[model samples]
Target: MKKLYIDYDLFLRPAEKDQPHCSYVLRPGNDGPACLREEISFLFACRRCEDYPCVNSCPNGALKREAGLIKRSGFLCISCKTCSIACPFGIILPELLPYLAGRCDRCIGRLKSGEVPLCVSSCKNGAFRYVEEDDLKGCPDIYPMGDSIIVKVFNWLGSYGIKK
Candidate 1:
């Protein structure tokens, strides 16, 4: 099975606050961004085990595990509840919803904007990136050489009419 690796310690650094803390799963062709099914599944499993208090503590029914995804309905989120207080996973930043609908939406927005998301953009070091599952089999473990490699490569190619 393919695995997504994240440097949790890197995310904690004050310098990376603008960046998304986790790497996105890359998708193939037009299939779309890497489906986050695996990551969502992991979170759901953790919730089931009650390893974290989030599942039980969510005041709003906004948080739930379904279809191997840690799904959240923003419309249903009252903003009165303190879901983050119970989980503290930081996965769901209720505060940023006006600008970011959710974690995955933030990532997709970055890709659409022709810019890497804050996390990928803010890394002074090339520490974060999205890699397709199949590509991971042969890729090196280290972060890709420089920050914003994806953005740079895509932009450069776009000059030649090559759309990513």
Candidate 2:
């Protein structure tokens, strides 16, 4: 069975000897088509709103608040996408299957064994990291997109007297 995993590492800058050496990055993984997309991020997207709109939007009661986090009941879910639509930040994706609603368990067995999660240890470039949520303070929630061919053409045209 395929499992969804987080990458937990995002390199914002290249390594430089004179710059301050910073470590730690966490983001959603995009290993395969089945894996979570790099564009989505639970840590950065989920605001944990006071109203819990996602949970309340579940008509079948598939989502519930447990221990301050939203938990999804796969069996009860009909994949109606109500939760996703209700989420103001667009964190809960509508494409999510019923079973993937409340996916990450943080690898309980690994933690009990005094080891990091499989994704963290499996990273080849030493990019994966684990850090307290507090470290993410001030990090921007929105990320810029890389320019595409269409955007480049538009920019070039806009530089001239080309209108529309």
Per-residue CA lDDT of model 2 for 22-50, tens digit only, reads 11223233122112221333323355678
C-alpha lDDT values of all predictions: 0.40, 0.45
RMSD of candidates 1 onward, in order: 13.6, 14.8
Query: Candidate 2 — which residues are off by over 4 angstroms?
Result: 1-44, 99-164
- Residue 23 in candidate 1 has what lDDT? 36
The positional error of residue 131 in candidate 1, measured at the CA in angstroms, is 5.3
Report the lDDT tens digits of candidate 1 across residue range 1-164. Answer: 22223343343343534444433444212111112222322332123323445556667676676653355665666665475566554544444323223333335555666665545454554544444545554543233222322211113223445332
Clashing residue pairs in candidate 2 (N, C-alpha, C atoms within 3 angstroms): 8-25, 8-26
Q: TM-score for model 1?
A: 0.41
Q: Which ten residues in a row are the worst by lDDT in model 2?
A: 145-154
Error of 2 at 14 (Å): 19
